[model samples]
Target: MAGATPLRVLIGKVGLDGHDRGVKLIARALRDAGIEVIYTGLHQTPEQIVASAIQEDVRAIGLSIHSAAHKTLFPRVLELLKAQGAEDIVVFGGGIIPDEDIPILHAQGVRRIFTPGTPMQEIVDFVKGLGQ
Candidate 1:
């Protein structure tokens, strides 16, 4: 474990969702838990997020989408990652997604979907567990 690299995660906001307070808080929590975080900021396209995740060599990608575009955007990220041969990078998401779409997103290769009011510790633990 002496030479182990710290876990890295890319937290991003894709689409026109300008509200970033939640993603920022999650980023801070992940960093405080010792995970290196790359936040791509707001209004990023799925292409930009996947490219950044691959470039940053992150273990996972956490996307926050509140624009009701989860059905399209989430899978696009997965598709892009697969296209780039980076499918090993775990993909998860959170935000104003509806309950019925949760299973759909999972089926589309999103590892997890955290809704609003989910405990921050659970997110931290999930991301940390990715390195295991």
Candidate 2:
């Protein structure tokens, strides 16, 4: 592991949503899978998320939103990332998002959206596959 580079991911909770249980689970799971996870805690703004992603130089961002703000917040994060020239950083998320909104989020540059009951290994494999 000395010379090999591990894939890094930023796990964030944006907007006013305070429920962090799921995000914490993901952070731990990703860490256990050998991915470096930078958890930004709760109530993070889109700007703050992008800034941290830029600073951490992560390969991806996994946001957990349960406040139904994904429609607005996710796109804002993507826009800010693009404006900051960090567009290459993959943006994905998981939460109580409705199925109808997934396509819009994808169009806004969110690479993936995992709903409740998604297997942990699937999330792990998704991020790992990004390296390939």
Per-candidate local distance difference test: 0.94, 0.93
C-alpha RMSD of candidate 1: 1.2
Q: Could you tell me which 10 consecutive residues in candidate 1 have the lowest summed lDDT? A: 1-10
Q: Among these predicted structures, which one has the highest TM-score?
A: 1
Which portions of model 1 miss their true places by more than 4 Å? 1-3
**lDDT agreement of model 1 with the native:** 0.94
Residue-wise C-alpha lDDT for candidate 1, range 10-81, written one tens digit per residue: 999999989898999999999999999999999999999998998999999999999999999999999999
After superposition, the stretches of candidate 2 with alpha carbons farther than 4 Å from their true spots are 1-3
Question: How much is the lDDT of residue 122 in candidate 1?
Answer: 98
Estimate the overall C-alpha local distance difference test score of candidate 2.
Answer: 0.93
Write one digit per residue (lDDT tens) for candidate 2, span 18-129: 9999999999999999988999999999999999999998999999999999999999999999899889999999999999999989888899999999988899999888
Clashing pairs in 1: none
- Using all chains and alpha carbons, the TM-scores for the candidates as numbered come to 0.97, 0.96
Error of 1 at 93 (Å): 0.8
